[model samples]
Target: MSTRPRRPRPPHPLRDRRSPWWRSAALAGALSVAVTAVSAPPAQAQLDDATRRITEAVSADRLRVHLQAFDEIATDHDGNRAAGTSGYRASVDHMVGALREAGYEPRLQTFRVPYFEVVAPATVATVADDGARTRLPSREVAAVEHSVSGEVTGRLQAVDTDGSPGDSTSGCETGDFEGFAPGSVALVQQGECSSGRKAANAEAAGASAVLVFGSGEWRHDRPARGSLEEPGAVTVPVIGLSYQAGVELLDAEEVSVTAETVSELRETYNVIADTGTGDPANTIVVGAHLDSVPEGAGINDNGSGSAAVLVIAEALADTEVENTVRFAWWGAEEIGLLGSDHYVSDLAGNDPAGLEDTAMYLNFDMMGSPNYGRFVYDGDGSGFGDHDSYDAPVGSGAIEEAFHEYFDSVGLASGETGFDGESDYVAFIEAGIPSGGLYTGDDHTMTGRDARRFDGRAGEPYDPCFHRACDDITNIEFQGLEEMSDAAAAVVLRYATSGDGVDLAPPVTGPGGDGPLMALLGVLAVGTVGLATLLMVRRRRRGPAG
Candidate 1:
C-alpha cells in the first residue's frame, strides 16, 4: 500500500496488459482439462500424513474468531490498528496473549519508523506577471509525506519539466537547476526516480520550496499523493499537485506554497515466535503484517492474513517438524515496509549466519478480498519479467510450483501476480532469501475474463473498501478466506517438514522444461508413475498438431 502515492492504480505488471480473448479462452480450456486430470488424488495426498493433518486442522471458523478479535480491538482503540497508536499496542498484546496461550514465548523486535501527519491543509496559488493572483483548489494541492513544515512565496521555475509523457528525468539532478534562483520555488514532475531525491536535489540547489506534479497518465484531477520516503530527508516544504494544476502553473511568473505538518520518528515492533522443535539452520519464516492504515480497521487488507498465520501457528505448535518455523507479525508495514526492512537489516548486520540460515520466507497479505482471485507470486518470473533490482532467489521457482500444485490438485484456477515490492516479502526477496506468497487482489479491477475464471464481478475493485474506513469485518469474503488460508497452511507445512528440491543452488535445466504449464505438470507428477502417465497423455494430445 505504501509503494507509491494514493491515486488511480499504476501500470501493474499483472493488470496493465491484456491477453487476446481467444488466447485466454484456449488457456482456460487447457487449464480445465489439466485440473480434471490431476484433481483425482488431491494435492494433500502428496504431502506427508502429519503435514496433511496440520493443514486440515486449519479451520475457517477458528480464523474468524481471530478476525473478530482484531475487529473488536480496532473498535475499542479508535477504529484502526495503525502503528504508533494505542490500537497497535493493543493488537500486539492480543497476539502475544494468543501465542502464550498456545504455549510459545513470543518476543518483540522493536524499531523506529518515520512518521508524518498533516496538521493542517496545504495551500498553493499562482501569481501573474501583472500582479494578479489565482488560488488553486485544496483538492488540487497536497503535502508530500514527510515534507518539512514551512511557507514560501517566490518566482516559479520549471526544472527540466516538459509536460510530456515518459519525460520523467525532471529535477532528478542538481544540474537541472543550473540557472535556478536561490529563493525561487522549483516545480518538478514525478517520474524515473523518487520524490525524495528530487526534493533533496532542489534543496541542495538553494530552492526555498519544491512542488512535484504527477505524470499525465495518473492523478490527473486530484493531487498526486507523493512521499519523501522518510522524515528529515529534506528541509524545504514540499507539495504535490495534479497534472492539470502543474501544467497550468508551468508558465506562471510566481507561485506560493504552504505546508503544515508534524514529522518525526516513532517506535514500533514486530512480533516473532519460533517453534523450537526443528532445525534452526534451515528455518522457514512465515509472516504477515499486523498494522493497518489510519483510515480503517483493515480486516481484509491484513487482518485476514494475520489471522491465517496465527491459526496455522497455533495448529502446528505441538506437531513435529524438520525445519524451524518462525512466525512473524510485522508492524508499520502500511507506511513503507518499515518493520520487515528493519528486521532483515538487523539480522544481516548483527547475525549474518542467521540471515543466511533463513531457508525461505512465506508471506500472506490481503488474502480475503470480496471480489477475489487466487494470485500466487510469480516467483519464476514466467508471467512478469524479472525485476532489474531484485531477481527472484534461486529456489523461488520451486516455491511457486508448490502453490500451483496445491491449487491445481484441488481443481482451483490460480493466477500469477508480480512481485512488485509492495509488501513485506520485498525485504526477504531483496535479502536473497527465497520467497513466495499469496494475495487475493486489492484496488485493481477484476477483468471480465478473470470474472469468468474466478466467478466474481467484473469492472469492480477486488476490495472496494481497500484502505478506506469501511474495511471492517463486513468487508471480508469468507470463501476467499477459507481457500487462501488452507493453501497457506499446506505450503507452510510442506517447507517446514521438508526442504527437498528447494536447494539454494542455481536452477538446473530439465527435460520437463520450464514453461509454466510444463513446470506445473512436473509438480503434479510427484511420482514416477504419475510422470509417465502425464508424458503419455501429453504426447497423445500433441500428436494431432504434430
Candidate 2:
C-alpha cells in the first residue's frame, strides 16, 4: 500500500506462456466489472463455491483460538517462541497436535541453523583530535550477528560514504578500500550488499574492525542490527551503529570498539503435512513461518499467518480437490529463511521430478497488523520491478490477478508489495516456482495512499510491535485479519481445485499425454518430415545434373 516507486529492473528471464488458468482474455473479462454473481464457466463456479465455503468456515474466531494458544505457549516458556528455544518446540508440538486433530499425519523435517546472541552490551566510542573521548549511547550500538568477541582501537576511516539518503556503496567493493590505511576501523553504510561482504572487505584491507551504520529510510534513532551472513566470515569484530551515532564518528580521527557474543548452530524442525485427496504430481505448498524473533511472543508477527493456514487446512480437510495441498510451517525464518530454503534445496537435489511437479507455492506472513493494509505480492512485477537478482517465474502474474479478482468480487480494495525476498516465499520464487501470497503489513510506514485505502493511521509503521516484546495477541487487528485470511483461503482453494493460469504439464509416465516426453516426440516427428522433404528436393536436382 506504500505506493513507493520502484526502480526499473532487468527483464525477467522466464518466458511468458499462457495457462488455462487466468489467460489474458479471461482475466480482462473477469476484472472488467464486479463478479458478485459466479461466472458461467464451470471452473469459475467451482472456484467461487470453494472460496465461499472455506472463507465461511475459517473465521477470525478460529484464528484467535490458535493465536491464544501460541501466546500461552510463549508465556509458559521465556516469553518468546524463537527457534532453538523451548518455546518454539512447544509451538511446533501444538501445531502437530492440531494437524492430527484435523486428520493429517504431519511430519517434522529436521535441519540445523546458525544461531547468534549478544552476551553483553557492545561499546563504541569516538576520540576527537583534542584527545577527548565520547562514548556513543549503548542503545545506538549493537554487535552485528556472528561478530567475533574482541576489542580494537584505531583511526576511524569512512569508506566511500557520502551521507546521502538512499545512495551509498560503502565497503561493498574492494576498490572502496583502495586508499584505506592499515589497522583503521572501517566505517561503512548499510546498503547495496550484504553486511558480510563489507566486513570481509574490511578485514582483507587490514582493518582491525568494522562499524556498519543505518542509512536511507531505516530508523536512525536505534542501532541497525544485521547479520554478517555466516559464522567466521571475518576474523575482526563487526558492530552496527545507528545513523546518528555513525554521523558523530564521520569527523572523528580515532575510535574504539568492544563486543561480546555467542555464535553456534541450533537444531530445528519444519512441520509438513499433505492432504491426500488430490493428485500428487501437482502439489500446492501453502506455508508460513512458525518461528518468531528472540524478542517476543510474536503473536501478530507470525501467529496470525500460522493460525490462518491451520484453520484453512482444517476447513478444507474433507473437501475433494484435483491438486494436492502441502501445508508447511517453516522454522528459523527470523535469522534467515533456513527452513524453506532447506526444503526446496533438498527436493531439487533428492527429488528433482517432484520439484518439477510442484505447481506453485503460497506464503502468508504477518496478516494482522494493527494498521493493516491489504497487500498482495507483486507477481506481475508491475508495482515493484522484478527482483534485483532472480526472475519471478512465469504464471505468477496470473496468480496475482486471481487475488485481485477475489478482492474486487468482495468490494475490498488492495495494493501491491514487491517481492523483496524478505519472507519464506523467497525460496520458492528463487526456485522458479509460480508463487503469490497475501500480507497485511510489517514495520514499513504506511503512505497517505495506504491510509486512504485501508483507513489506518498514515505515516506510521504497519506493525509498531514488529520484532519486539510487545507483539502479543493484543497487537492484532481482527477485522483486517478476517479480510486477509478470507482472501488467502479463497485464492489458495482456487489454485488447489484448478490449474487454470498455471503451467501444469502432467508428469512423463507414458508415450501419450502432454508432457516433456510427448513434446520431444512431436519435435522428432517434425524433424523426420523435414528430412524427407529435403531428400526429395535433392533427388529432383540430381536428374538435372545427370
Candidate 3:
C-alpha cells in the first residue's frame, strides 16, 4: 500500500492581510519545512540570487523593444496579418530579425496554407406567409454562388418541407427526383446528406432555387461555408440557415431565400524563430497567435502573450539553459487554429532534423486584459462535472508549478485553470507536448461567481472590446500590464536558472496536485519569512537612527 497519505493544505498566513509580503513568505517557508522535513533553506537563498539576475536581465529596454515590435505588427503601419498575407510576411521578417538580434538564430517553417476572405455577404432566408422566418449572415451563414450572377423568382414550393431528409427531401439516391414540379423553391433540412447531393437532387427535380436549414446545432461564433459541391452545369442558387431558422422557414406557407459564397484559394505564412541548434529534436517551444479580428488591433487577444514571450526570450539570451527555446508567431489563429495546425501537421513526421526534439511546448494566447480572469490550466486534471480536463505532459506540470512558486514568492493569488481550446495551446496539447500558459479573460462578461473568485469587475467582459476596434494600446492599463509582465519574467527566469530546466517533473504536480501538503507548508513558511522581512523593510522605510 502507498504510505503517502493525502496532505491537507495549511492555512494561508497572508490571508490575514495585516502581514506584509516578506513576512508571509517566511511563514509559508516555515510551514513548508515543518510538513516536508525537507531542508530547502539553501534553495530559497539560491532562488533569491537567481530572481535578482532575472530581474536585471528583463530590463525596461528589452520590454519596450518587444512592445514596439508588437505595435508594428498590430498598429503603426497597420494591416491585416492574415495568414499568407503580405502583412504576415513582413511580421515574420520582423520576428526573425528580433530573434537574431537577441543572439538567437531564427528560421522560418514554411507550409502550404489556404487563405479565405469574405468577398460577399452570405444571404439566404425565408420571406414567407407564416411568422416563422429564417436568415443567415453573408459569411458565417451558409451560402452558394454560381459562376454566373442573376436572381430567380417563382411560386414557392414545399418540396422536402417536412424538415426531414429521409422522406420529404431526396435521400442518398441522386435520381430520386421522380415527383417534383418545375419553377419551384426547394426547401431541404440539413443532415448527413452532402451539399452537392442536395443541390443535384433539387436540380433534377426541376427546382429553380434551393434553401437549406442550418446544421442541427447551436453556435456562438460566426457562421461559415459548409461542404462544397463541384460546379455543375445546372445554374441555380442555394443557401443555408440555422436549425431554428430552418424550422421556421419550413413551416412558412411561402418562402423566398438567396445565397452567395466565394470559393477561392489564398496564401499565408507561419513565422518561426529559434535560439538553439536548428535541430528540432529535444527543444522547447513557446508560441502565440499574431493576428486579430478585422475589427481591432489584437493587443490583448495575443499581443500580451507575444510580448511576454519576446521579453522572456530576450532575458534568456545570455543564459545557458540546456534546452533550446524557439518562439513562433502563428498567423490566422482567429480563423480557427489554422496556423498551428498547419505547422504541426507539417512537422509531425517529416521532422528530418529531429523536429520531434520538441520536448515541451508553451503556448501564450491572451494575457494582458485588465478585466480578465487569470487561468493556469491544469493540463492533467480529469474532465469532471461541467468542465473537460486537459492532460498536460509531466514537463508542463513542472512549468506551472514553477509559476505558482514565483507568484507565491511575490505574495500574489494565482489559481490553477483548465486547458480549453480557446488559444494556441490547443495545437501543442493535441500534439502531446505538455502544454501550459496564462490567460486573462476575453470580451466575455464575468459572472458574480467569477468576480468573487478573481476580484475583477463582474458583468463586464474580461476585455471590453475583445475583438472590436477598441482593442488598442491606449486601452491597456499600465499597472496591470506591468504586473503580468513581471509574472512572466519571474516564470521565465525560474525556468532558465533552475538546473532541473523548465520542466518540474512529477509525483510533485502543479499546485496541490496529489494533495496540497507541500504547497501549504511552503506557503505558510514562505509567508512567515516574508512577513518578517516586510517588518524589517518598514522599519527601514520609517528611517533609522538620527
Candidate 4:
C-alpha cells in the first residue's frame, strides 16, 4: 500500500445544475402516501425551503472533496479500499471522522469474514489411463472463494450436467452425486443451486475436490468465481473451469489439480450514521457500499456513489424530519454483500424493531460510471417481474416511481434496470421490504441501444476502468454525479420529512392515473396502521468492495 498523494485530479470536468428541482407532484403524492391515515399532517406537505437548500448544497465540488479524501486513503495504502486492508480501515476512519466533524454521532459495527487471497497461480492438469499427462491453459480455470488450499490428484468423475454447457440440475441434490467415491474429483455444472451447495454435495459424497463450470451460454454467463453462498460451509477445494476446460476434464479418466489459496480470518467495519431526529418507528435507510475492489481506488465504481451519500448526509445533518433517516456505509460488499447482509441478519436477531421500521432501502452503487446510464431498480418488476423475475417486495414500485418522478422533473429520461438483487438492496427485498436505487453499469458493455438511450459509448464497458488501478478520481463523470446526487438528496429529504408510508395506510389513488391523492398543500393526515418497512441486498461478492 502506498500512502503518497498522487497529483490532484478534479472528480469531473463538467458541472451540472446546482439549483434545486423538486416536483410538486412528488411532494403531493409522496406525502399523500406517507400520511395515508395518520392524524395531523404537517403544516406544509410541499417541498420545504429547507429541502431546496440541502439539495442545492450537494454540488459537484462538495462531492469532489469526499472522493479526493478516498483517493488519498487508497493512494497511501495500496491503491485500493478493499475490506480487511489498511486502506479500507483508513476509508472507514475518514468517513467516521467526517460524520463526527459534521455534528453527527457515527457508530462502527464490526464483523469477521473468512478472508481469501491468491498467493500462487492455480492450474488444472489431466492424465490418461496410459500415464500420459496434459496441462490446460491458465485461462481455462479459476479458484472460487472459501476453497480449501490443497493439491489433489485422483479419478475424474463428471456429475450430471444435463449434457448442456451449464443448465438444469447439474447438482441440485445428493442424488446427483450417486456412486461418487471418496478422494475422486467431481465435475459439476452451474445451475439450479448455489455453487457452495453444489460443491457441498460433492464433498458430502467423499469427493476430494470439485470443479464447477459455466452453463449453456458459454463465456456469456457470469464469472466462474463468486463469494461462497455460505463461506465456512464447504470443506474441499472448489474450482471454476470454463466450458471447454470442464469438458476436457470429463473426457479424461484421471486428473491432477492444484488448488492452493491463502486465506485469513479478518475483521471489517460498517459505518452507521443517522439523523438524530424524526420518528423512531419509521425509518428511511439509505446506503452505499464504501470499499473498493482490490485493483484500484474504485472512484467511479463506488467513490462516486459514496461521495454523493457522504455529502448528502452532511447536508441533511441539521434538517428536520418526521421519519428517521438512517445512512449506512457498508463494508465487504465486494466479498459478498456481507456487510449489508450481516446488518440485516444481525438486526433480524438483535433488533427486529429496527428492521421492521425500515420504510425503504435505497442503493447508490456506481451511479457515476464514466459511460453512465440513469438506471432505477425495477421495483415494479415489469422487466424481470413475473414468475422467473426477482421477488421484490410490495412497496418497491412506489420507490421506483419516486425516483422516476424526480428524474422526469429534471428533464432527464431515465431507464429501468431489473431488480436482480445484485446490490445492498438484496436483503431488504428478501425480508419482503420494498427497495429501489440508482446504478450505472459496471463491467457490462454499453450497446447500440444504450448509446441512444444514455448517449454514452456503446462499445465500451459502462465504466472502462472498473475494478482496475485506473478508477481513481479521474474516472468520474461530473455531470452524472451531480444529477444523481441531487436526485439522491431530493428523495432523502422528501422521505425524511414525510409521514411513514409503512406506519400509515396506503394512500387512496385519485380517480385519474398518477393524479394527486389528497388536497393540495396542508391536507388532512390519514390514520395509522401496523408499521412495517422495506429492505433488499444482492451480490455474489468479490468486488474492490461490494
Candidate 5:
C-alpha cells in the first residue's frame, strides 16, 4: 500500500485501528524484580558511561534545535504543525531523516488520515419569545468538528429525553427528531451514541444545525465541545454546548448559529526505526507523537516529549544493548491516538507474534509543559481506580518503577497520572503490551501542591497555550526538558541493556554484537585472566610495603 502509486517507500502492512488512568505515589518499591534471575548488570562504570554518552548527546541544546526545527516547519506552513498538512509531513521527514543520519534505517508507515479543522469561530445566540437575544462566548459554544459551513436561524427544538443516563440521548436516534420543524435547530443531549450519528440524523430530518449537551458527567472534559466519530462523513452545522447552555436554549423559541469545519481525507505517516541489532524476542518500543494540534507550534504539547525521545534515539545509535530499541514518531495524535493505534493494529494483524516480543511500550507525551509537573503513568492500576482503569499489562508497573527510580536518583519529586487512554500508549496497553510513560501536564490546571512539589506556576494550565498559537519554541521549560530527557535516557538504556523483568538472551557486548558475543566474551575472558595475573604480581611486590 505504501509502494504502489508512491513507489516512494516499502509497502507497510496495513490493518485497522486498535483501541484501549491513575495518580500519585512515590519512587518506592513500585516494581518487583528478581535480582537472582537476572544476569550480572553492567558495572557502575559501564552503566554511567552508557547513560552519560546518550544524555550528553541528547542535551537541551539538541532539544532546542529540534524545537526550532518544528517551529520553523510550522512557520513555513500556516503557523501550525497539524497532521495531514505540509507542516506535519515536514515533521515526519525531519524525524526520519535524523534517524537515518544516525545510522538507523527508518520506515515510513503511511496511512490515510481523516481530519477536521475549525477555520472560523462559530456563533450560538439564543432568541427568546420576547425577542431578547443572549450570546454565548465562543468558549461556551463549541463547533462540532467536521461540520459543514452554514449560518442558520430558527426555533430551537429540544430532542426528547428518556431512559437512564438522566440527561436524555436526545438526538441519538432519528425518531427523537419527531415533530421537529424543517428549519429548527435540534438540541441533542450527550449520551449512548456518538455525536456524528446525532448530527447525521438531524441533517436527514432537515434540521439546520445541531447542539449536543453534556449528560451531567462532570468529567466530560470541555462539556462545551465535542467531535463527531466520523468527521469526514458529517455534513451539517453542529455544535457541542455545556449542559447549562443547552438548558438555556431549551426555553428559546429561536436560535441563530454559524459553524464552519474544514475537513478532508489527507494521507499521513508514522516514522519507525529500530536499533537493528538486539533481541527480536525482546524489544522496547519507545515513542512520542510528532504532530501538534492545529492551533499552534506544539512545542510543549509534544515537542518537549518528541524532541526528548528524538535526541535520545539518535544518541542511542552509538550505545550498546541487548534488546531491540524501536523508536517511533507518531502523527495525528491531537485528533486521536491514530498513528500509534494504526501501528499497533497493523502489527497485531500482520505480525501477531511481534506483539509478544515487545517487552514494553514507553510513552512520552508532554515533557515540558510550561507550568510542568513531573508526572508518570500509573502502570499498576494503583491510581485513578476502575472508572479510569487502563488495564495495563503485567509488569507495566515495573516500567513505571524504572522511571520512578530515575527521577528519585535525580532528586526530582514525581506524581502519577492515570493511564486513561489519553495518549499514544492506549493501543499497546490494550493489546496486552506492558505500557508506561511520562507527561508534565497539558491544559489541566496545576494545583498549589503540584506547584510546590514541581516548582511551577499554579492556578494555570501546565501549558497555558497547550493547543494555541502561543505554543511555539517559547512554550518550553528547559529545566524540565533536561531532567526528563535524562530520565528518559536512563530508563531506555536500562531496559535496553538488561531486560529487567523480561526474558532475553545474555547481554551483548555492544549495539550490534549479538552474533559474535560469545567470541567477544571468550576473548575478554582470556584477556581478563592474563591482566589479573600481571596486576596481582605487580601489586604483591608493592603491596607488602604498605
Candidate 6:
C-alpha cells in the first residue's frame, strides 16, 4: 500500500437540518424507550470530566467533513477503491487530511493483495449435452483472479462441497475426485470452501475446467470466471454455477468453459494524518472504511460508520485527551479486511518491538441507518451482568464495560452479539489488542420479532437497502443516528480523559487486569460483616439503656 498527500476538495453544499419531520407510531414507540433510560445514574465522578470532553468532541461541523468525503468517494468517486485502485489512493488522501485536522497523526501501514482484473473470451456452459450450450452474460460470469487455467473436454463431474472449510482440502480430500478427473470439468458447491481454494483444488487435480455452484440457492449460479488467486498457483479457468445449473450438468458429457485473468499493476493508497497532539505510544484509534462498492454509493453500508467517526474526530481535535487519538479510513474492506490487515501484519511481522505501546483500537462501521440496532461486542464479557442477551469478546473488558455503562445510563434496551468476521475489527482482535465499538445491524432482515426485541421498525431489513445504490443519505433514521452518535461519543470521551479505558499500560504490566474487581473484593472482605460491629459500637457509645 502507498500513502497519498491530502488533496483538498471544494466544500459540499449544505443540507438543511431543521426541515419538517414526521414520526411513525413505531418510531414514536422506539423513541419512548430511548428516552426512558435518560434518568439512569451518572457515570462515576472520576469519569465526569472525560465524558464531558468526549461528548463535546463529536460536533456537527466535524460530521460535515465525513458526509462530504462519503459523498465524494461513494458517488463522485472515480471508481471502486479495491486494494490496488487509484480511486482507493484518493480516498486515503482524504483520510489522512481529516485525521490531521482532528489532531492525531497515523503512520502508513501497507500490505499486498492479489489484484485480478479480466482477460480472455469467457464461455459458460457453451458446449453441454448434445452440444446444446446455454451462454450467460459476460460480466455476470467471470473468473476470480487466482485460479489455474487449462482446456479440457470430458464428462462434467459434480461434488457436494457444502460444509467444507474455506481453503480446506477435506471435501476434495477423498479420491483424486475420481469422477472429476483431468480433462474433465469439475463442479463443486460453494460453502465450506473459498472461491480461491475450490478453484485451486480443481486445477490441481488435473481438471481442465472448474464450475462452483452457489452453495445452495442456485445449482449453476454462474461460471466462476472471476479472480481465483488461491494460495498455491494452478492456472485453470474456473466458473461459478447456480445450484440448479450445476445439477443439470451432472449427467452432461463433454462440457467446456473458458476464463482468464487480466493482470494489472494498479495502485491503492492509505491516508495518514496527525493531530500532532500526544505521544504515538499511548494512542487512541477510531476508524471506519472509506471505499464504496461499484453498484451504488455505499452511504449506509459505511457512510453511516464513516460519518460518525469523522464527527467524533473533529469534536475531539482541539480538546485534550490523556492519550493521543488516531483515526483511520481503511480502503478495500468489502473484498476482504484488506486495509487494516495490511497495517497490522506489516507492523507485527516487520516490527514486533513497536506493538507493545499501542493501547486501544475503536471501530465504527454502520452507525447511521433508518433502521439500526445498537450493539457492542463484549471484549471480555466481564461486566455482562445477568443480561443474557449480550455476548462480549474475551479481552474487550474495558471497552465493553464502557459501552454497557452508556447503554445502562441511557436506558436503551441493548443486547450484545458475538463477533463475526465481517468487519475491520478482526485485524486488531487477532493481534490481541483491546478493541471494541458499536455497529448498527446490517443486511440482516428485520422482523416483527426484531421490532419487539429492539425498539425499531419491524418487518424490514435492518438496513433494507444494504450494500446497494439505494443506501443514500435519506435512508437513515435520525433518532437511531443520534442515539448511536451519543453512545459512541460517550465511550470515546470516557476512554480519552481518565480511567483504565484510555490507560495504555497493559493490564499485566500494571496491577494485573484485576483493577475492576478490587472494589468488589474490598466489599466482600468487610462491608458484609462489618455492619454489626459498627452498630454495637454506636449503641455502646450512646449508652442506650442508661
Instruction: Please report the candidate that would top lDDT against the real structure.
Output: 1
Q: Rate the local accuracy (lDDT) of all candidates.
A: 0.79, 0.78, 0.56, 0.72, 0.72, 0.56
* Candidates' RMSD to native: 8.4, 13.4, 9.1, 11.4, 12.7, 12.7
In Å, residue 269's CA in model 5 sits off its true spot by 1.4
For model 6, what is the C-alpha lDDT against the true structure? Answer: 0.56
> TM-score of every model?
0.76, 0.70, 0.70, 0.73, 0.73, 0.69
Evaluate residue 521 in candidate 6 and report its C-alpha lDDT on the 0 to 100 scale: 40
Instruction: Give the winner by TM-score.
Output: 1
lDDT of 4 by residue, 1-546 (tens): 011111111111111111123233323333444534433222123235665577679998999999999999999997899988899999999899999998899999999966776656677788877777787777877887777778888998888864465465777799988887778998888777788888888898999988887774657333366446544578778888777677656677788778787666799998999898998777888999998888889887688888888999999888878988889999888777889999999989999988898888888888788888777777766555763347677777667667665664445556667665557888888886778888777767777666666677878877778788999998989888888888888878767877644432232344443223222212333212211100000011001110
Model 2 CA lDDT for position 265: 76
Query: Model 3: per-residue lDDT, tens digit, 92-149?
Result: 6767777788887766666554444434554655554555555444444555433112
Worst 10 residues of 4 by lDDT: 533-542
**lDDT by residue for model 6 (1-546), tens:** 111111111111211111011011112222332322223122222134555456555554455456656566655554344456655665566666766655666556565555655456556654755677766555445565554344455667665544232322423443637565667677776654466666666767776777765544332445433345432355666666555555555666667676665454344544444344565666666777766665556666676777787677767677666666667777777767787787778779877755655577788777776676666765554324234323333447557556655554434545454455567778887777778887777766655544654566776667776677676666666567666776787776655665443553322211454432332343244443333332222222221110
TM-score of 4: 0.73
Judge candidate 2 against the unseen true structure and give its global Cα lDDT, from 0 to 1.
0.78
Q: Regarding TM-score, does 2 or 5 come out ahead?
A: 5
Q: Lowest lDDT 10-mer window, candidate 3? A: 1-10
Assess the local accuracy of residue 231 in candidate 3 as a C-alpha lDDT between 0 and 100: 41
lDDT of 2 at 464: 86
Pitting candidate 1 against candidate 4, the one with the higher TM-score is 1
lDDT-best of 1 and 2: 1
Q: 1-546 in candidate 5: lDDT tens per residue?
A: 000010011111110001000011111111213232222222222235566577677788989988999989999999988888889999888887888888999999998788877778888898777777778766667787677778888988888853124546678777887888887888888877788888888888988888887776663335445667665566668888877677656677888888776777788999889996778788899999999887788888788888998898888887667889999889888877899999999999999889778888999988877787777787656554365557787778667656655554344567777777778988998888888888777776777767677777778877778778998988888988888888788888878887444532222234343322333333344444433332332222221110
Candidates 4 and 5: which is better by lDDT? Answer: 4
Error of 4 at 175 (Å): 7.8
Better of 4 and 6 by lDDT: 4
- Judge candidate 6 at residue 335 and give its lDDT: 64
